[model samples]
Target: MEDVISLSVGEPDFHTPWHIREAGIESLEKGRTRYTPNRGFIQLRQEVSSFLSRHYGVEYEPESQVLITVGGSEAIDLCVRSLITPGDEVLIPEPSFVCYVPIAQMAGGVPVTIETGPENGFKLTAKELEAHITERTKLLIMPYPNNPTGAVMEREELLKIARVVEKHNLLVLSDEIYAALTYTQEGHICFSSLPGMMERTIVVNGFSKAHSMTGWRLGYAAGPREIISLMVKLHQFAIMSAPTTSQYAAIEALKNGDDDMAYMRGQYDMRRRLIVDGLNEIGLKCFEPKGAFYVFPSVKSTGLTSDEFCERLIYSKQVAVVPGSAFGPCGEGFVRISYCYSVKHITEALSRIRAFLEEL
Candidate 1:
């Protein structure tokens, strides 16, 4: 624990920018700590609307379409709870963020995993999606700029999925929480930008990953007024409001933090290449990740299960990475290594990993 080079964290290592922090501080200094509206402050919601439109060309009415919540996790929970009915089936693609299955189960919906492997760069295919649809299928969690695996979908690929969603009348919870950290050449594509997707997709985004506001716990859901209204009710009864200071901070992030996001993104891109190449050179057989801050490297050649590899590495070499199996069964032969750390930190971890592999 004392000397571990841990790469298991899934957040930005950067400090929240001073300007953003100042906004929150200024709000407190102005005595702005009262409970915001159930759907969050109107100004913040407007900023979210403007931010989404400016970046992704996805428009939503600030007053009716956006509902702020306590991080993307809460937004995701609201989407599943509000939309899912008992005995309904929710289609999820894995290895994904860990909450989808449990959230669906809590709503008395069946959680079905659509396995996505490295064969197709981990992007979900139309064939894979269509095959999983059932009469009971009601929602699909479209998590791109994905966590754990760092996969993202291009516009064409998202269009393929849009067609499937339309044919099946499936609603989608498109989690774009990692939207800004994408390494794709075309940048992040919002799922709602696809034809007919705006009506069917609930876009969940937040400030944690891109803005380094993990502690601030601010996120918002942008979608149809019908759904946002329902989610607001749940939020009102349960959460009352997101943190007031964080909401103020996020307004600043959405309004003037593009340069900050761009700077952080460039740093992440460099670290991404560093870890992916290092893992491949060490014979871990990692594929290049196109989004997020993590790399999924296959440890199959080491003749160890994902857990065994992770445990042995941590115990013997003092290097920590999450076993891919923690994400899903399809992730069994791999491990997730994060590159949110500095270059020297990553370099040391790679060296330790190389030594660990040689010992194996």
Candidate 2:
């Protein structure tokens, strides 16, 4: 624990940009602390709508199609519960974020895992989706610019997926939490922006990753007004509104935070290259991640399970990283390292990881 270098946290090391924080402070100073409507402040919702339309060409009616929640996790839960029924199957691609399966199960839906791997860039294929389809299958959770693995789905690939989704009449829970952090030249493509997909997808995005506002606890889901109405009803009973200050902060973030996000993304891109190269040189066989701030490298060469590798690394070298298996079983031979820390932090962690590998 002493002098340990951690590359485990999937959060930006950057502070919320001054202007955005100032807005929150200004809101409080102005005595704007009363409870907002259950669906959140209408202006924030309108800003979210404008942000989505301008950035990704996905348009939603701010009044009825958007529901703000405590965070992306809450938005995701609302989506699952709003659509899933007992005995229905929810298709999830793994190794991904840890929440989807549990959320679906809690909604009385069965979680069906579809394993994706490096051979296909960790993307869910149309063939795979078709194969998994059954009468009981009701929803597909599309987590792109994915967590843990840092894989991104391109528009062409998404088009293929959309075809299948339309054919099967399946609804998609498109989690775009990391959409703004992609490394591609063309940038992120909103799934709902694809033709015929807008009405079929619930888009979940938040300020936590892009604006470095995880502590703010704010997020929103936009989609068909019918589905959003259900989620809003649920949110009203469970959570009255997202944090008032956070909502105020997020308004500023959406309006003027693009520069801040881009700056942080550039830093993360630099760190991403460093860690990927470092792990490969250390013989960990890392895949170059194209999005998000994490690298998932195989630890199989060390002749250890993912859990074994992470535990041994932590105890022996005081370096902490998460075992990929914690995301899903298909992740068993890998470990996830976050590049959201500083260049110095990532460099030192890489050095220690190399030393640890040499010891083994």
Candidate 3:
């Protein structure tokens, strides 16, 4: 009862591995402190290109198709800014990561949110995609291996969406930061991997999730040469270059970090099953998540709104889970519980949640 547990944040609990840290220190020791090319260090870009092809079967030329950014967050902002014009509509599925809609709005684009519920496994269907398109639709922010809900679009599902995307001639900002965390029957699928979809898809991925390097602040985007170049131009003005130390470390990560990723994925998979089973046993309905480290469980049966449940839990039980409504309107009636903590912590947190619900 004395221990406090928090399940609110989606970040790896693991420390950045030793070799990657050493790579950063080595860069500083060698005085490799100067500004890298605006696009990023050439070596890092090459590594990213290779990593993508090897892991996801997506190909891109290092010199023309990659631009390293501060994080996946910045990569997303740049993609939206470069493509969206005033009054252009960008399709977003909820409950998704929070930044997409705001970034689109900041770029003078209209954000049209489509609600995908638990009944559908939180996936945005091809029918939903087609129904939302119009002449003004310019971009679709594809946040799969999704954040709050941890939903993933399988290859067949992505192909269905690709058909709609092709018919509408719209651009796709595909965020695959959590691709390595998929836990469902099938692994994650990149929309860009589909035939003809690469030309229209801007892929954003980072080492934060996979390499446990969030503090390193490194990520990259890849796409057609023309789009990548425009993003680089904007990146040059906005962020002279990504952090030099992080770039050096990222090189080591792409080259030697695959084992580290596999280890973390296995741990997450165990924690995921524990939390999902525990929640269901306590009468909270949780949709099994196929990717990412968070679980979205409905709190409606407790007769408390998502916000009310989260507030009460934090104050009374010393447990913190984010209200799903904070992500978007469609997220109402659910709360997001992150599995990024220790297994013991997850066990204790769920027990407290169960006690709280029983009291209701």
Better of 1 and 3 by TM-score: 1
Report the C-alpha lDDT of model 3 over 1-360, residue by residue, as the tens digit: 355688988889999999999999999999999998998989999999999989889989999999999999999999999998899999999999999889999999999999999999999999998998989999998999999999988888899999889988989999999999998667878779998899999999999999999988999999999999889888999898999999999999999999999999999999999999999999999989999999999999988999999889988998989999999999999999999889989989988998898888
Worst 10 residues of 3 by lDDT: 1-10
The lowest-lDDT stretch of 10 consecutive residues in candidate 1 is 4-13
TM-scores for candidates 1 onward, in order:
0.99, 0.99, 0.98
- Where model 3 places Cα greater than 4 Å from the true spot, the runs are 1-3
Error of 3 at 128 (Å): 0.7
lDDT of each: 0.93, 0.93, 0.93
Q: After superposition, how far is residue 329 of candidate 2 from its true place, in Å?
A: 0.5
State how far residue 95 of model 3 sits from its true place (Å).
0.5
Residue-by-residue lDDT tens digits, candidate 2, 90-150: 9999999999999999999999999999888888999999999999999999999999899
* Deviating ranges (above 4 Å) for candidate 2: none
TM-score of candidate 2 on Cα atoms, chains taken together = 0.99
Error of 3 at 15 (Å): 0.3
The segments of candidate 1 whose C-alpha lies over 4 angstroms from its true place after superposition are none
